[model samples]
Target: MNDKNHKVYLHKKKYTRDKMKDYTFLLPAGLFLTVFLVYPIFYNIILSFRDINIGNLIQGEQPFIGFENYQTVLSDPLFRTALTNSIIFTLATIIFSTSIGFAFALFFNKKFPGHKWMRSILLIAWMTPIIIIGTVFSWMLSGDNGIINELFISLGVMSEPIYWLTDTDTALLGTIIANVWISIPFSMVILLSGLQGLPTGIYEAAKIDGATRFQQFRHITLPLMKPTILVLLMLGVIFTFKVFDLIYIMTAGGPADATQVIPFLAYQLSFGMYRFGEGAALSNISFLIIGAIAVLYLYLIRKEEVM
Candidate 1:
């Protein structure tokens, strides 16, 4: 009886040890995610439903306000303008950044003299601090004595210096240009990695079969790179949608609310205007938009895999 009992006890201990080993691998990540990611998300959701403000924040009396803040944000003209600008900014960034990045990937993927140096230089824009980029671009696009205007004038392209960031019509465009400059490098790096990962034999086979470069790119390259391209597109849309620093630093969302995006609008509502509830509502809305895009991207990815 003692021998039998000893063997059973040792087996139970081994079983418990194996279970612990399985959980050990997941413990750290689970803890980190719960603390950092899950907590903030839940807190933000709670804040969005509350009438939180500076005073209430200090007093810890953040009471719920239902959907009143959301209604106010939806009805506001300023919010409408911000929504429009955000859509435009997101669309333009997606088009220009993705296209330019793909072009650069093609260029950089080839073995050429100083290719490494060229790639390093291109990545400088990505590596530079956003605040510095914003400040330098603001100075360069200044209406009066900006380098861009001076260059255009010297080249006789306009026959005069153009006020790039002063007019409402041009202000948003100027911000987009600055954003594109920063974003292109990211897209290029991602696409370049995808390009490099592609099997070379496929291209060689296509070439041997009398396929032209354009045909190969259209049929082979594009299809093969679809997953990577989708990821970049989704990321570009999300990043561009949340653009705040560049617009805030460059235009403060205006010459006349021309460059205001959802994030900037939320900032103004919360900090600048002291409407914390409305700011939270706007933030929630932005989150919804981005969340929707992410879901769509996931669906597409899954569908592609299924096909």
Candidate 2:
């Protein structure tokens, strides 16, 4: 070959080899996701279409019932209730957690005495396992001799103890409160990072412009923190929507299904009730809902990047 052609061939060969090495590095993670994540998702989709309850779950080649499972899940009154509760629970937790977390993030962003220590102390709630947090909250919210009740009585807020988990009126609200506490630290950390990353120059300029603290936050801080807030809300909704451990530990979807969200109901159907198809169907529905939200979030992020 000519000198130039030979050099070009060698360059192409080296490029191919380097690309192969890069693929090799990704192979393990790709295989792991295919095996553990992709396979199960596809398998669950297939399972949802089959008539495979406990009776015939072990048997091979179960009958394909098509949309029967979906119809059953969609038509159920409990499913409707669970859907509503899930929406309410997810929205409530995200709103309260993000608001409280944003406040805390702003507080800690300023360097003050013991600021780091206080921030670390607040993270304890998020660091603790959700089940443990739920258990502690369960005890605290107990109608009899609970600290919450004791505090309320002491302050004359109520003459009697409020049954948080046992009452239909307060069961979902109780779970929302627990979830908000658990979620706040994560939101705070994200927002805090965003806040710390903001340009001091802008804030100084705003101060020089005679802007008040609230005016600076509303005009400068919020606009700069929009991306971080979007990411936090997206992640918070996805995580909170699938919350099962906390609810199971606390109320078990009790008090007349007051706190029966979709994830818990899916568990009840698949394992508790042994209705595999229905459970799979319910899970698939939730997956679609989350999937749509994730797609929208990604699109928004891409748009922002383009901008």
Candidate 3:
């Protein structure tokens, strides 16, 4: 009995020591996330409940108004418009980006001359800074000297050059186009990686069974790439929903708040209009929208794993 008790005590000590060593590896990352991610989230939550505008921001005597800020933000007409625009923008970007990216991936997946070179060239869009892309596209879409308007006119699509940025009707579309261009390369790269990682043995077996290329892609390729596709779509939705720089530089959310999405709206509320609490509320609302999508994605992934 004494020998058995001694063995148990020694085993417990060794297990604890091993657990502590494993925890040490995670300490630095846990601390970094707490400081940068957790602190900001909690700070934002606190600010959302208070009236901390430009005038009182410096004085720091913000009165806690509970849900008034959120109520005001939700009730605003511009909030409705921003919500509509955000959905349209996010959906449009995701659909076009993913579709085009998949098409590009399929084409490049085949062994062909200059395929590697072409793929690298396309990636330049992703590697370039967002601000630069926005700025350059702004010039290209200009009413007078813009290449897009000029080409459209030359092609008889329109009789005259159109103002892409200053017009309310076209501002959001212009921004989405720019966003799609940026998003495509990212999706392409991800899908290409998935494509390249597919089992060669399975494909060869399918070929031996006399499966057509389309049949193989529909039955095998898509099933295998489901995880990657879901992740890419989720990333696209998240990225497009929180888009800021393109809208800010290209249209500044407007001819009349036409291009304002939630993040830019939050900026307008907090910094532009000096309503910090309302801005924080909108920002938190944006987080909720993204969070819902993320939750749904996790649920799908869990179900897939279970199946």
- TM-score against native, each model: 0.91, 0.95, 0.92
How do the residues 1-307 of candidate 2 rate in per-residue lDDT, one tens digit apiece? 9999999999999999999999999999999999999999999999999988788877665799999999999999999999999999999999999999999998899899999999999999988987789989999999997899999999999999999999999999999988998999999999999998999999899899999999998999988898999899899989989888998999999989999999999999999999999999999999999998899999988998888
Query: Model 3 misses residue 241 by how many Å?
Result: 0.7
Top TM-score prediction, candidate number: 2
Where does candidate 1 stray beyond 4 Å? 1-32, 55-61
Q: Check candidate 2 and list the clashing pairs.
A: none
Q: Give the residue spans of candidate 3 off by over 4 A.
A: 1-22, 208-210
TM-score of 3: 0.92
Ranking by TM-score: 2, 3, 1
lDDT of candidate 2 at residue 235, scale 0 to 100? 96
Total backbone clashes of candidate 3, pairs 3 or more residues apart or in separate chains: 0
Kindly give the stretch of ten consecutive residues in candidate 1 with the minimal lDDT sum: 40-49
Off by over 4 Å in 2: 2-4, 302-307
The whole-model lDDT of each prediction reads: 0.91, 0.94, 0.93
| Cα lDDT, model 3, residue 89 | 96
